[model samples]
Target: MAEFRQAGGKIDITATKAIAYHEVVVIGNIIAVASHSAKIGEKTSAYTEGVYEIKKGNEEITQGAKVYLTTDGAITATAEGNTYAGIAWRNATANDVVADVKINA
Candidate 1:
């Protein structure tokens, strides 16, 4: 079988604060991940337009579920008061530190 799908592009932004590598951050639908360590007010590599493998804390998420950015620079299933980051591309267990998401930034 043959199939075709779409992916995302990389974008950079000025960090509001220090961000670790692969940490997910979101301001509304504008989601991104720090490609490397970036200090506050410095330009860091952020993938705002592409799928990213981000860090998820102890929270578990299902496949195809919508992921949100937390206050502590993390991803989770709870979006009650969080910023929408992207969609989970796979199911993530509670023990899994990483979650795959197709970011819609």
Candidate 2:
């Protein structure tokens, strides 16, 4: 089984006997801002993908802004100037995959 842990919550994945890796992606307008954490074991890999629409908050994040992830996890963000438009993740294990993202309001 796989596990996912975030700063605000956690989830125990029950679908591991069939999948060795999982990737999730989201793209749209971001109305809210949030942060999260993720961890991947050594047997599975997980990835998260999405696009963020900057509606508020500080627009200092550039397209190459550093997006931090948990151990063995990675985050990629694509933004136009200070407006972030997309986000992605790459998990290189089967530990805990968790992250926080913005939603379109």
Candidate 3:
């Protein structure tokens, strides 16, 4: 494959803790999904705007259901009048994973 101009790229940051792939991470007010695994003090990639399998909270999420960002960096459906993270790209059970998510929250 040939490399072209940058369409989207991940920002480099020092991981304070272990970050898994496809997990939602927030830097300041910016929300992005982890593109690669990174341990504490390691450099890794994270990007926004692409579909990703993000960690879900205790609430069950249905297809097309809207989700929100929890305090722990997981996506949830119980914002309770707060801002949402994005919409569910696939049906997900509680404590399971939600696939096909795009950042809208």
Report backbone clashes per prediction: 1, 14, 0
TM-score of each predicted structure versus truth: 0.70, 0.18, 0.61
Highest-TM-score candidate: 1
Kindly report which residue stretches of model 1 are placed more than 4 angstroms away from their true locations once superposed.
1-8
lDDT of 1: 0.79
Give the per-residue lDDT of model 3 (tens digit) for 62-104.
8897777778767777877435677788887775754456775
Error of 2 at 47 (Å): 10
The segments of candidate 2 whose C-alpha lies over 4 angstroms from its true place after superposition are 1-47, 67-105
Q: Which stretches of candidate 3 lie over 4 Å from their true place?
A: 1-6, 58-65, 80-84, 91-99
Task: Indicate whether candidate 2 or candidate 3 has the larger TM-score.
Answer: 3
lDDT of 2 by residue, 3-58 (tens): 85564322233332333223331222221222322234223222322343322232
lDDT accuracy of residue 80 in candidate 1: 90
Q: Write the per-residue lDDT of candidate 1 for residues 1-105, one digit (tens) a residue.
A: 957553446566788878788777664468776678888988877677667777788978999998887777678999898788889989999999988888873
Q: Quantify all predictions' global Cα lDDT against the true fold.
A: 0.79, 0.30, 0.72
- 71, model 2: CA deviation in Å? 21
